[model samples]
Each structure stands twice: as structure tokens, then as C-alpha cells.
Target: MTLRTATAGDLTAIMDLERTSFPTDAWSEPMMQSELASPHGRYLVDVEAGRVIGYGGVRAVQGSADADIQTIALAEAARGRGRGRTLLRALLEVARERGAREMFLEVRADNPVATALYASEGFVEIGRRPRYYQPDDVDAVIMTLDLVAWAAHRAADGTALDAGACS
Candidate 1:
């Protein structure tokens, strides 16, 4: 798998996976287009055999103390291979490089795999939004991570956090 900065040209592929992963509340094309064009957002696509299979994004303004995880999705066939974790770590690194001290994200309450991934990354649940996901009416799990502490922990374990590893 090859992960790299996403371009507008990858929109169609990204949307395909996005809709498949989040059928109940997939982002609209216009909204996704605006996100890809936003200065505050950094998106990445995972490609395999020249086909886009996964994608994720983070919104971090320069000099900001906090950032938001915009989204992360992998094609059904690509699940359970640590690709999602790789995409997530890359996004966190991007936010940290942009001067973010904390990272925040919301996951569907019904999605245990995603919630577990975030939790394993040191994200702690801070709150929840009832029925935040429409159509499905699933609750949203709000989680946050302190980048400083996370980096320190990784260093202590002698594990280098290299976003480029995915690239």
C-alpha cells in the first residue's frame, strides 16, 4: 500500500470508499471538494496497485493548539490490515507538525473497531452526542488525544512516530 497526500483527482475514488464505509451519512461531493480545497485541512489517500483504497484527513490551522480529525475510511477489502491505524497516525503527525497540541475526533457509537483504534492510540472519551449520526440515529463518541503526551509515550517505548512510513 502506498499512502500520499490526496489530490482533487482522487475525489472520485475517495467518494466511492466514503459512501461504502458510511452509507448512512457519507459526505456530499461538494463538501468533500471544499475540504480537499481547504487550506486548513490535510488529506491522504492510500493506494494499492494504482487504485485508491483508503483515505483520511485532518483539519489543523497553522499555530493552532488543537486539530480535528476530519475522517478516515478504508475499502472493505482493505480492513483489518493496520492500514486504518497507519492513516490515523499520519493524520496525527500532520496535526502535530502544524502546531496542534491536541487532536479530536468523533466516531459512530456503533462502530467498535474504529472506537478501539482511537482508544489504542491514547484517545480518551470526553463526551458523546446523542443521535449525532443521522438516518441510522447512532450516537457519536467524542474522543481527544494529547499530542505531547502521546509523543512522549512513543519515545519512551523507543517507537519512532514517522508519518512518512506510510508514504
Candidate 2:
């Protein structure tokens, strides 16, 4: 799949995937629209054959010491193919570009696949919010990544920290 910057024009397709991926607690259209319009927000979508298969977003300000990963979701058909990792890494790179020294996110405790992906990427559990997910009553596993440490690991592993720009 190819990755590129997400735009407001991608809203409908993104909302479709967002609803499908998080049926119980998908974000409302207005909220997403605001996020997409925010100057501090960075979002990306992965497309294949003109279909949106995955998307990720982050909230960061230039020279900030910390950034928060807003969301990351993939179409059911895109799982098990490393698209999540691709999107995640891209987001991290974007955060670093925006001058973030660290990053954070909250993943559903019930999601082993996503949790594993985060763990493999050097995100360590820093805290948890009890029953943070409504309806399902799932806990939110809070994770954080030290950009400096992650970058050193990437360099040691021969992975470019600045993989690519969002656009």
C-alpha cells in the first residue's frame, strides 16, 4: 500500500473506515473535521488502488516536548500485512519532525494485535485508564515512546528515523 498525507477531502472515506473499525465508539464527523483542520494535527491515510485502507493521526506542536498520537485504524482487509506498523512509524517520524521529544497514545487493552505492534516499536506501558472505553468497558493501555531512544534504536538497526515526510 502507498502512504500519503490525509486531507479534508478524505473525510467521507475515512469516516467510513473509522466507523467500521470502531463501531462502538467512532468519532463524530464534526470532531474529525476539526482535527483535520487543526494546525497542530498531522494525519495520514494509506491507499491502495484508490481505496483507503488505513489511517493514522498525531497532535503535536513545533518544539513541544511531547506529542500525542490521536488515532490509528486499518480496514479489516488490511490487517496482518504490516500496514499498521507502516502508518505508526510514519506518524512517529512526523512527530519528530514537529520537534517532539516523545510521543504517547492510548490503545484498547483488549487489542493484542495493536498492543503487540506498539510494544515491538519500543512503546512501553506507562499507565492505564480503567474502563476508558465505553460500552465495552475496555481499559485504555497508555503507552509512551522516547523519541531519542527510539531514534537510537532505529539507527542501530539500520532503519532510517526520518523514513519519509507525511506529504
The weakest ten consecutive residues by lDDT in model 2 span 158-167
- lDDT per prediction? 0.92, 0.90
Q: Report lDDT (Cα) of residue 80, candidate 2.
A: 92
Question: Which number leads on lDDT?
Answer: 1
Cα lDDT of model 1 by residue, 60-111, tens digit: 9999999999999999899999999888988998888889999999999999
Off by over 4 Å in 1: 164-167
On a 0 to 1 TM-score scale, where does candidate 1 land against the true structure? 0.96
What does the lDDT come to for candidate 1? Answer: 0.92
For residues 57-144, what per-residue lDDT tens digits would candidate 2 score against the true structure? 9998988999999999999988999899989988898888888989999999999999999999999999999999999999999999
Residue pairs in clash, model 2: none
Residue 52 CA error for candidate 1 (Å)? 0.5
For each candidate in turn, give its C-alpha RMSD to the true structure in angstroms. 1.3, 1.1
